[model samples]
Target: MSEANAPRVRVLVADDHPVYREGVSRAIKARPEFELIAEAEDGRRALELVQELNPDVAVLDVQMPGLQGNDVLHAIKRDGLPTRVVLLSAHLDSETVYRAVASGAGAYLSKESSRERICDAIAAVARGEVVLSAEVQAGLASEIQIRERDQRPALTPREHEILVLTANGHSAPDIGKQLHLSQSTVKTHLKSLYEKLAVNDRAAAVAEAMRRGLLE
Candidate 1:
């Protein structure tokens, strides 16, 4: 097909840093396959443009002012928008990777990535593929190892059962009734499990349990 006939991938760039945003804008403008639809210096504006423009893909800085990239991604998902997202970050930390993957972001890349890689990521995400940099993979690997190493073996069978029930959305009284234990007993078990998992609440305990592979 002719270049003019080719479908252009509509893109929105959002970042708090002007230099990086301009660099990305220039890169997008240089590519014929990509059409820069809009740019925003904060997450709130980014979200507004996304809702208004409905671009094919959104390239977002992870640490933007107002709302963060992950927050925008979550909002997009909650609103059931069709725009795919690619998150850019200065570092590929485990929490960021976790949120990106969990929130259905199409790509996670470093701000230091080359222009070619950035363009490739935008195209990849526009094509509905998940793109992860080597740095993100390494961070994920390290996160897995840390979770494995910190796996809590001190949780008793009852505690594990309680956690699994809690993860399944059971209330403490419901779990107690199902397990033939008193509500106080269930709460006590939950407290002990939270201590072992280094969490403060049932929700955190459940999330930590799932992360550590203690609850499948």
Candidate 2:
């Protein structure tokens, strides 16, 4: 199809800051390939408009009142909405980038990114491509490496201690005595460890932890 006849990609912009939202909205409006459908000042309203208008792409601020950008992204995924999402954040930490990428965001960009870059990301996302800025891409790579090196499930410090004691063949009550914790509390930690390790008993938990290098 000719460029003039091509359908514009519908877009929604949501940010708590009116100036930033307007700036982004204007950029979208100026793009010949994109159509600015709506603007929301908060996440809840963003989600509501998304459901109502079914835009092809949504540009969301990571931090917003009423519902976080991540929450809205999850809701869209849960409801199986066809709208692709582009997340914008002033904070671009590795953990944040990892979480956003893992949760199905089509793109993650710092708010400091150029308007042209944001517009390009929305266009790419609408075409079913994942877009990441250079900084975001580096952060995501670092986060993935950290995750890989620590393959163990999320265990609390107390749980790690319990696992160590259990590996030494200490019973739950014995562990409680050594740690000066109540027997019930020790058992609770043990139960949580088992659940996290996906094991049914202390021995299995210890073995799983060892295999996962949590004990090393």
Candidate 3:
């Protein structure tokens, strides 16, 4: 099919590694339906190219000099660029996966993914689909579960001690005396606990803590 008549997907490839960028460029070139429009050696250049070329999809490295992949993604969104981003990273930690997805990245790919998988991700994003590698999916799932499990108000050790003392019928002054803190400081901790526990007073704070098993 002639280039003019063919349906082509324009792509921008960005990475700090010369070898890796070249490999990805070659992969994009190998597919007739895809066109390699631009390449960047850093996140800053990647954003520049995105503004200039406005490629349908951008393949960005998660770690790059000048700006990281997530930063680039935010820039694209801020500028209202009609580009879908596929983030590539060597690390697939839960936080990384969660952040990428949360930042509106179209896909998350590990550096160890096969060339075919990378190509598939690009195609998927071009088709307006959100793609997550198996590892990324697992990491995101685990992160979500952990966040849900730890949704309760977080209390510091000192706060826990204070709360326990308060539950045992100790006033702020008494608790402060036992913990070697000033009454004002004890009141400050109580205020913080009230906000965290979403309660108004001492009784409500203690009740919420007990309900969440935070006191135990």
What are the TM-scores, per candidate, against the unseen true structure?
Answer: 0.69, 0.72, 0.71
Worst 10 residues of 2 by lDDT: 147-156
Measured by lDDT, the strongest candidate is 2
Cα lDDT, model 1, residue 48? 99
lDDT of 1 by residue, 61-158 (tens): 99999999999999999999999999999978886797688799999998999988999999999988999998899887777677666665668889
In candidate 2, what are the lDDT values of residues 1-216, reduced to their tens digit? 998999999999999999999999998889999899899999999999999999999999999999989999999999999999999999999998898899999999999999999999998999899999898888899999899777769888999998999999999889999999999999999889888888998778888988888998
Pick by lDDT: 1 or 2, better one: 2
Off by over 4 Å in 3: 1-6, 154-194, 199-216
Task: Provide the overall lDDT of each model, using Cα atoms, as 2-decimal numbers.
Answer: 0.91, 0.93, 0.92
lDDT over C-alpha atoms for residue 138 of model 2? 82
User: On lDDT, who's better, 2 or 3?
Assistant: 2
